[model samples]
Target: MIEGPYFVLVVLGALWCGVAAGVFVAFSTLVMRGLGALPAARGIAAMNSINVAAMTPAFMVVFMGAALLCAVIAVVTFVLWPEPGTVELLVGCVLYLAGSFGVTVVANIPRNDALAKLAGDEDSERSAAYWRRYLSEWTLWNHVRGGAALAASAAFVLSLT
Candidate 1:
């Protein structure tokens, strides 16, 4: 049974993961679709604005704080091997760190960076082409990260049981 500081940490981690999941799921479900429905230039501009806004301190704290907690939990889980909830804790950490955070860094951010560099001219063939690809690819990866974050939250909750 999880207890003491460890239990508290896991609970915090669960909450953070759920929050991250909610944000990602919003983008995956409604946000991206709404942006895609706009003109190519408009979509590009909106996404770029969103990308910039996402870097704000509030969002970064939650997103990166969850990652930090996951890392700490993973190391502690290993150090205290054979403990109850070890497997669940480890699963939760890996799912969040790799599936959610890792994909964001590896797959999504690069696409956002590329999109940010575009001129966003409605008549530009290049902007339109990239926008089409970005809409599909970015949203696909968003779905992946969102699912991972939710799964990680569930695993953390199970650790307490």
Candidate 2:
């Protein structure tokens, strides 16, 4: 059975993944929907505000810390090959690193960066068009990341058992 600092890390990783999953799920299920219901300009403005708020130290520590932990776990898992829960631990690492963290870097952040460039003027056709597409695309990616984090958390829990 896994023990010592390694075991503690895994437990923490599981909790972190669960927290990340909950945040993503909130955006996918409720936050985005509520924002989308607003006028296009208002929705864009609100999302921009949310995006800025998300960068605060509290959220970043959890989100980025989870990614860092996953990377460390993956490397350690490789070095300590054939240990108990190896497969499950590796699965959790990959799910969070690639599916959640990687997707955020590749898919969501770019879109957010683009959205940030917009003036969010109510009369601007360009902003309105982008906002419509952003609502659907961003939320779709959010759903994927949320599922991945939840699955990672489950995998980590399985490793403990």
* Candidate lDDT values, in order: 0.93, 0.92
Candidate 2 lDDT over residue span 1-161, tens digit each: 78899998899999999999999998899999999999889988888899999989999998999999999888888988899898999999999999999999999999999998985464599899999999999999999999999999999999989
lDDT of 1 by residue, 40-135 (tens): 999999999999999899999978998999999999889888899999999999999999999999999999999998954655889999999999
Give per-residue lDDT, candidate 2, residue 134: 94
Stretches > 4 Å off in candidate 1 = 120-122
- Model 2, residue pairs in steric clash: none
Q: Give the Cα error of residue 50 in candidate 1, in Å.
A: 0.9
Best by lDDT: 1
Off by over 4 Å in 2: 120-122
Q: Count the backbone clashes (under 3 Å) in each candidate.
A: 0, 0
Quickly count the clashes in candidate 2: 0
How far out, in Å, is residue 78 in model 2? 1.2
Lowest-sum lDDT 10-residue window in model 1 = 116-125
